[model samples]
Each structure stands twice: as C-alpha cells, then as structure tokens.
Target: MDSTKEKIFRCAIDLFNDKGVSHVTLRDIAEKVGISIGNLAYHFKNKDYIIAEAFGRMEEEKMNILSGVQQIPSFENINNQVEPLLNISKKYRFFFLDTVQILKSYPAIKHKHQAYVENSIRYVKAVLDYSVGSGNMSPEPEDDKGLYWRVATTAWMHLYFWPAEVAIRGKSDPDIGEVKKMMWGVIKPYLTEKGIHNFETIKKEMYASA
Candidate 1:
C-alpha cells in the first residue's frame, strides 16, 4: 500500500503486459521503478514473490469491481452485471491477456495457476448464487446444471480476452455491445420465463441508456 510498493507493482504489471512473464525479471521491474534491485527486494523477496503480489493486487481490483456491481439493487438486470465486466475488460485488458498467456505455460506455475482457477471458480459461484437468490435466475438449488450454467457463463465472458489480445496486436477492438448480444443468446435458454422477461427489459434499458 505504500506509494513505492504501488509504483513497483504498476511497473511490474506494465512490463509483464508488454513482455511475457517468462521474459521479465526483477531487474526489469526495478529499472522501471527507478529503484535498485536491493530496494525492490526490501519490499518483495524475489521474482515469484513479486509476481504473486501482482496477481494478488489484480484479484483485489477485480473483487472491488465486482463489489461495485453487487451493490446495485437489481441482479435480474443483465446490464448491471455485463456493464461492469465490460468496464473491467476496457481497463485491465492487458492484464487479463497477460494472465491468460501466463496460464498457458502451466508447467512453470502449475500450483499458482491452479490456485487462481479455483479462486476464480469460487468467486463466480458466489455471483451465481447471488443472481439466483435475487431473482435473476431460476436454477434449482445447487444443482449440477445450475453449476454448469454458471461456469459456462463465466467462460463465455472470458471470450473478451481473445478480442482484447487481438486489439493489442493491432486487430479490431472488441465491440462490447456485440459481446453482450452473443452472451445473451447463450444465457437465454437457461433462464426461466420471468427471468427471460426481466432480461429483455434490462436489454431495452441498456439500449435506451446508450
């Protein structure tokens, strides 16, 4: 939380986004922060330690974003959820892409990656539970089908990562509106009749606001 520590984390995140994690070293972060490696070490013990801290910071930011949505009164409104996710994609586009790329190299960070996946699943499950409880969904209590839908929806949202990385490579930026439409198609069949109506109403409100 110290200003210097925050600077180091931001510098490390930028470097990791520009260069793959495997290619980044503590020296790179230290140089970026304009601090000595020894000084950096005074805050973080090693490269892995710094990487873990960076990931923790990312998780914290994500939780904060989710918390903002959780405070919204209407869980049945898809826009209330989707909008924050789009905001997250826009703000942390590079971070998410870099994290996915790092995850592909599972052999190097197997345990860390597994922990991240498990934590992500738990976070998503909590959101799904909230949605169901708040009348956004009609899933049977703790049913496997309900669980599957939640997990699948989470994966569907992750599709944004592909377009985000592509845009980084000079391809077209992702259209968040189109992404919402596609996601709605995938989510519609799972919703109850009331849920469907609520979804449509939310969609109309979203468009009207736009």
Candidate 2:
C-alpha cells in the first residue's frame, strides 16, 4: 500500500511530466493527489522536495531491475538493464526534456544527477570488464583505463540524449521500444564476433519477453 507521501510523489511525477517542472507548483501536485495543501505540506514542504523524491523513485526502480541480473554481467545482462531504463526514462519524459532548466533552477539537483552519471559509467565499465573476462571481447586495450572511460563516456552521451534528441529535432515521439534499439549502435562498433553473438541472443530474449 502507498502512503500519502508515496502517492504524492507519484502524482507529482505525472504532473511534472505532463505540464513540465517550470509550469508546476506545490498546489498543483496537492490538487492532483486530491489532498489538501496542508496535508501535502505535512509531507513535502516544497516543490524541490517532491522533485528529489521522484528522482529517488527512478533510482529505486532501476535498482530493482538490476537486482534480478546475474552476478557477472554480460551483453545479455545489459539488454535487461537498458530496456527498462528506457521505459522509466520515457515515463518521466519531462525530467529529461526540461533537464537543463531544472538544473539551472535547482542547482542542488546537479549533485544527485552526477551520482546517476557516475553510476552509469560504472555499469558500462563493468560490462566491458565482464566481456573481456568471459572471452567475449578482446583482452587487449579495450579494458584499459583510458579506453574504458572513452567508451563509457560516449555510450552514456547517447543514452543521456534519448529524449533530448526527440525534443531537439521536433520529432514525433518514437516508440520507446524502438528508441531503445538505437542503443545498439552506441556500442556496436567495438563489439567482437562473440560479443555480437551474445548481444543477438539478448535481443531475441527481449523480443520474446516483449
């Protein structure tokens, strides 16, 4: 069962994603949740408080998806991660669409956002390392510190822009499932034959599960 605070948090994400952060206020969230202003204030005193909680909820959802993965992650494992993350990203589209403005408005968000960025980099590095360990990738320079950072940084750049790209080109909101497919291009060049084989397997699994 959701507590009043949890309901408010979810309601705020919907409101913010629909009307955008800049256009939303505490009263709007309170009204959407069918709670009085005083009741809402009893939980989240301000808009920033609700926004931060919403971001925390995203992190928690990601953690739940990852928790089901194998110990030594693989290309297959990464597919498990990316698809759900994309869904969550699309669900909270306003956060990405208006990210810059939110950051500028609430400078404190940068700290938590940086944490998410670093976590993503770490996951990318782990996948690379696991590939080399499993003989699915070249044992040479691919896992070297410089190369690892370069690839992860570039990969994250693509993932980060998924929604921003849609907004920038004034493109129709493509289906999230198809948008997730574009991630394959991000890391495809570096993959070995074995890596590609494993990735294809994961792709099939994603299709079956979908």
Candidate 3:
C-alpha cells in the first residue's frame, strides 16, 4: 500500500474507533491524516473504499491466526490462539463496537462477515471434536445434544462482543492477559482431567511469559 493510503486508513480507523463510523466523514480522516480531502480521495475515492480496505486487512490478519493452528487441536494449541484473536479484536475495535449498524449498512461487508463467521464456528466445532477424540476433552452426554454448537456459539459471542461489553459497562479496556483468562473460562468446563492438568500447566507459562 502507498504510505499515504496507509496513513489514511490508520487515521480513519482511529477516528472510527473514537467516533462512531457513521459520524466520521472522509474529511475527518483526511484532516487527521494531515492531507487534504483531494489527496485522500486520490487514494481511497471515499469513506466506503477505506472501510472496505480496513476490513480486508482485518480479515487477512484473522485468517493468519486461524491458519497458525496447523496441528491437530489440543488444549495447548487452542490456548495458543486466544491471544492473537484478542489482538485482532483490539486492533479493529470499531468493527465490534458498531457491528450491528455496520452489518446493516454495508451489505457486501455483511456477506463477507457472514462467510467468515461460518468458517469460525466450524473451526471451533472441529477443535472440540478433535480434542474429544484425543482424550483431552470429555465427550458430550449420550443424548448428544447441541452442546458443542452452543459452546462454540457462546464463545464466539463473547469474543465478538467483549469490547462492546466493556464499553457498555463503563469499564476500561482489558489487556490481552485478562481477555485470555475470560476466554479460557468459556471452554474450561469441557476439559477433562487430563485437559485440566494441561490447561493449568499452560496457564502458568502463558501468564509468566506475559
């Protein structure tokens, strides 16, 4: 990306995070970037274009995090991914902060987000099943209700809305370490004795490294 375009995006995202996206104008981004609206237009055409690019970059970073888990899923491997996921959410705070309005206003972006969400849910379910097969997680009851689906969906809900939740509660933004602890709680109940042992061991190392 051109340096100017990069600056425009950085400024736009910052403004969007500070002010709601609907309230931010192209001029606001241009002024923040220290460039005239004309110069900003030369690179981005409009605020919509900048929004698309910002989401594209966010999607790329998130995909990289998902791809990092190449090995069969385990408690340790899943734990490794929590921090990166939280980092992505922090970097794109505006997206989660205004998720409903953005999805309503941008049909194309909404479609893309839906596709990404499907993949994410599938990934979580896959990890749960893999862990069960490997003896790290306990199996669901014999009735085999949608326990896994519910767990996966609930975890996704927490991750997607955590920033907004904090804001609504009038709380400060949490560090990744705090976010990781809460996220682990989402799946902690499913862990078997062996999994709990591994999780306890890994938690110490993860926090110590922090």
Best by lDDT: 3
User: Would you list the rank order by lDDT, best first?
Assistant: 3, 2, 1
The segments of candidate 2 whose C-alpha lies over 4 angstroms from its true place after superposition are 64-70, 140-145, 170-173, 203-210
**Candidate 2: C-alpha lDDT:** 0.75
Clash count list over all predictions: 0, 0, 0
Q: What TM-score, computed on C-alpha atoms, does each candidate reach?
A: 0.68, 0.82, 0.89
lDDT of 2 at 203: 70
CA RMSD per model (angstroms): 4.3, 3.1, 2.3
Residue 99 displacement (Å), model 2: 1.6
lDDT of 3 by residue, 30-147 (tens): 8888889999999998877878888888888876766665354766776778777877888889998898899898888999998888887777777777778878789988797889
lDDT of 1 by residue, 44-140 (tens): 8876666666556556665665565456535343355666666655544554666656556543555665565565555555655666776766665
Worst-scoring 10-residue span by lDDT in model 1: 69-78
The better-scoring model by TM-score among 2 and 3 is 3
Error of 3 at 68 (Å): 1.4
Compared with the true structure, model 3 gives a TM-score of 0.89
Candidate 3 Cα errors over 4 Å, as ranges: 70-72, 205-210
- Which predicted model would earn the best TM-score? 3
